[model samples]
Target: MSRNASASTRIRVAAGAAVLITVACTASATALDRSAETRSPGTPREAAALTGSAKLYRPLGDDITFTFDAHLAAEHRMDPAKATGTFRFSHYLDGRGAWAEGRIDCLLTGGKVAVASGVITRTDLPGAQGNRVGFTVHDVGRHDRLGYSWASVGNPVETKDLPKCVSAAPFEKVKNGTGDFRVLPWDPDFLKEG
Candidate 1:
């Protein structure tokens, strides 16, 4: 009888532990799901999130040249009529022995054929102070007809950068904007290219 009681107590203890573990796991999963939802589409999580490459070259002013190869993961949005996104880019400057990173809050209109505009912030060149530059991306063209992948040509909004000695700037009073740009899901394609 004692043996049987000992066996029963052991079983009960094990079962209770299992139940507690299950409850803890369920609670953890719920929390993760809620955090992900905050960044979901149309949730006002900095427009859109995307990973891609861009190359830009533009004369900032009469004496300053700004060019960069940008690898960026940005927040983006795409809909039937419009698309938009905000991006922070790691920029490699052109052969100047210098580097800079910056952010742009961009908008494009008219789906595949669109125009884009945004306020840009970048570390200062030709000066030690950072600056705010506005840009307009026009003649947007998408690579996929049914998708939002696109390229555009644009230029600075002003002939010179506005002196703003800050490292980063948050989008001010902007909720969301729309247009069309296709984002391809990431995959390991480089290994297959050989």
Candidate 2:
């Protein structure tokens, strides 16, 4: 073939390859997104690690209680799957499980997935926050996927059953939607009503 014709054919081949690659990546992303959405609404929508009954999580705080209405995203039979929630970060548990709260709907999917539609404080506790929490939880969730939960009680780091997240109260600085991983600490100072 002539030099110009050969060059033209090469360009066409390169364009075709690029198109194929783009299509593949788009399909993968769509599959993941759909998986996260297709699950039964009550089931978790992301993935996680943790199979034991006495499982644990980093708590948000004792000051706030939360309730969510989560819809499962299209996902695999994975644990700790990233679920989509629409709920309020209500009030304190009256030192119990909690009562009133507010709700919102946002997309909180990381390797960080939590159990939705329950009394969070009762179901989980807290964990290390910032870098450590993100890194560990991400790794663990990806590997195990659909084994654990994403909820907290108060100060999971304060609990004695598990190890400390760090020397400092890791989340004492970055407030809201962040924490370290640790078992839920039952409050000795917790009071209740009759």
The top-ranked prediction according to TM-score is: 1
The lowest-lDDT stretch of 10 consecutive residues in candidate 2 is 130-139
lDDT of 1 at 129: 22
* lDDT value, residue 37 of candidate 2: 70
Candidate 1: segments with Cα more than 4 A from true spot: 1-13, 25-48, 51-96, 107-118, 127-194
Residue-by-residue lDDT tens digits, candidate 1, 1-194: 69999999999999999999999999999997887876765344333223233333224311121222111122334321122333332223354433334443333322222222223454434442233443222223332111111112122223234332112211111111212233322122232367
Question: What TM value does model 2 have?
Answer: 0.23
lDDT for every model?
0.34, 0.33
Clashes of each: 11, 50
What TM-score do all the candidates reach, one by one?
Answer: 0.31, 0.23
